[model samples]
Target: MKEKTIDYVLRATWMAVSKMYNEEAGKAGSTMATGFALLSIDPEKGTPSTSLGPKMGMEATSLSRILRTMEDKGIIVRKRNPEDGRSVLINLTNFGLEMRNFSKGVVLRFDEAVKENVSEEDLRTFIEVAHTIMELINNKKIYKPETSAK
Candidate 1:
């Protein structure tokens, strides 16, 4: 049988992991995206609305939807940034902070479980390979189309 490509394996693993997080978040009355946003925001200081999307690697539309839901749920609040009049900052509510802690714990537990099962060397190698793949993509080193195709 032909072996699976690295991209296939990476996509499959991420899908599985995302599903797992979504399931856990559902039990906590949240979605994976919401949980991730909560985790990305600072607990003490607020995060700029404009910065959150890029920080989370989320599109503006998707992030806007999630932010709306979070605001409706009273998980977060948007306030005008004192530092920048044009920008808005996203701040977590009391409930949002609690949810953030829950999300953090969930992530930590998953990491701990993986570390328990996988050898340290293997984990390091996996991280290195993942980083390399990210660098390659970020640098546009792969999949360059011919000039005629452009």
Candidate 2:
């Protein structure tokens, strides 16, 4: 990978990671998205249905499909929010809790492997760079719509 652009590196790495996660999740009859959603929900307290999408960094349509699948699989159930009758809470079923534990283990194992291979300083720098990239994107620095109006 000589002279790879930062975008290329980012996309390539993420694609690889996504593939790896999907493969691992497949062994348990799941997808990476399902695993991620499972990990996002609180085991005991549950999470707001609306918040699940943002928490998982996905859009409503995408999250809706995953939630539907999870519901069909008996992994999750929607309950009325005790605090807000207008809102719904996404509660994990007993099976969901077990799946969440599996997801946690998978993520921890990935983290452990990375830590074992990458030096502390390198990992810190990686995180720093990632944050900076996210900040730039969030701030619309790369594609300034305001400036483009001219």
Candidate 3:
């Protein structure tokens, strides 16, 4: 493992970013996942509980636990979705709105700081590389048919 691979860099960078966000969230007595959830919910109209999992790329049990904690903290409330009687919508409370604003500011500041440091050309190239990697994975190009088994 003398030389690093692309996945290593991606994982390490993401881990660092996650840690930084968690630290920032700790100040407000929250976690990065909660902050993410707060941002994922629609500001005006509430978001469906079922959709939250897919939107956040989280699991049902995890989302349910976070939602329960948020509700207990008075940050959000669950109400019946008008359009779908069987579904429930998660609405942010006034405090949740304030928290969401705070979370947004943190993210904006992070983006601004990163943009200030990275040149536009480098940033564009980085984005293109990332997209290419995603495309490769999405199209199942990495692991293919037996044609390349040699």
How many steric clashes between backbone atoms does each model show?
A: 0, 0, 0
Off by over 4 Å in 2: 147-150
TM-score of 1: 0.95
Q: Which ten residues in a row have the lowest lDDT in candidate 3?
A: 141-150
Model 2 vs. true fold: TM: 0.95
> Candidate 2 local accuracy as lDDT?
0.95
Write the candidate numbers in order of decreasing TM-score. 1, 2, 3
Ranking by lDDT: 1, 2, 3
lDDT of each: 0.95, 0.95, 0.94
Better of 2 and 3 by lDDT: 2
lDDT of 2 by residue, 35-149 (tens): 9999999999999999988888899999999999999999999999999999999999999999999998999999999999999999999999999999999999889876455
- Candidate 3 error regions (>4 Å): 144-150
How does residue 145 of candidate 1 score in lDDT? 52
